[model samples]
Target: KTSLVVSYTTNGYPTEYIPTAFDNFSAVVSVDGKPVRLQLCDTAGQDEFDKLRPLCYTNTDIFLLCFSVVSPSSFQNVSEKWVPEIRCHCPKAPIILVGTQSDLREDVKVLIELDKCKEKPVSEEAAKLCAEEVKAASYIECSALTQKNLKEVFDAAIVAGIQYSDTQQQPKKSKSRTPDKMKNLSKSWWKKYCCFV
Candidate 1:
């Protein structure tokens, strides 16, 4: 997850991997020549953090629901664990299913290990089906190591998020004219009377 965040934010491959249970990274991306501040929240998949993780879901515009393609169990968790958890907290938020570690999909070492366990890399077709099952807004396959389709993944995310936000944005309430009784009040008198703020 950090790899996804680091690669997108900095555009340089991140090394010396370190894991943080709950981390937030901020990045500004240009969408149509306007800067959109994006906050990427990375959460640990450990069982203990599950209880505390959903607190961040409130008012979230979009979610990147990621799974490792080479690890079938992780893919399973997308349905069994992640999607349900996100839906419970932020039901209406748009979700983009992300297939991570695409670089490892065909690596000999990774394939042999999966074969030992009688497992195979999750296929793109199956992943797309899973995305549809979860009603995801989009499905993206990307490799953080090689930076393949990495930018596109985030671009899709930001675009979906922006669209979601636009629909959810409450229409502005026009300001009413000040009451006649309050209109003539002196500035100093008003400040002294309403200084509670």
Candidate 2:
């Protein structure tokens, strides 16, 4: 997620692995002389953050449910972990199923490693099928390293967020919670990370 936002906003790929626990980035682009803002929320996918992550979903307009194409476990999590979680929190929000790291699908070293594990790269057809099962609005495969289909991912996010906002429920003020788990969460949290272009 950080890579996606950083690549688009900075036009540079991170040289090393630097995980983000949580961060929000904002970008404003002038479209036809009108300024449009986009927010990209980078949330940790670790199991420890599962409870805290829902706090970011209260008013989410759309979800980009992403999984690495070369990781079978990640792909499995799309249906087993992600789709269910998002449905519970944002039932009406649109979802765009994303297969990340398409560039690695053909890497010999990666393929050999996966072969040892008796696994293969996820096929586009299978990804699309999963999208249908989850009722996702769209499915796209992209490689941030190569910038392949990267712009389409964000473009789809903007379009779907805008369209969903028109028909979806107004952002309901989430009930104030006082638990320590909720202490660091900001109101309008989703807005801090994402906006329609």
Query: Which candidate wins on TM-score?
Result: 1
Q: In candidate 2, which residue pairs get closer than 3 Å at backbone N, Cα or C atoms, i.e. clash?
A: 39-193
| lDDT by residue (tens digit), candidate 2, 50-81 | 88877777656778888889999999998998
Candidate of highest lDDT: 1
lDDT (Cα atoms) of all candidates against the true structure: 0.78, 0.76
Candidate 2 wrongly placed segments (more than 4 Å): 30-33, 169-197
Report residue 129 deviation for candidate 2 (angstroms).
0.3
Off by over 4 Å in 1: 172-197
Q: Give the TM-score of candidate 2.
A: 0.84
Give the Å shift of residue 93 in candidate 1.
Answer: 0.2
Q: What would the per-residue lDDT of candidate 1 be over residues 1-197, giving only the tens digit for each residue?
A: 77888887788778788865877778776778866778777877888877888776765778888889999999999989998888887788888899999999999999999999999999999999999999998899999889998998888878888777766653354254356534542221211000000
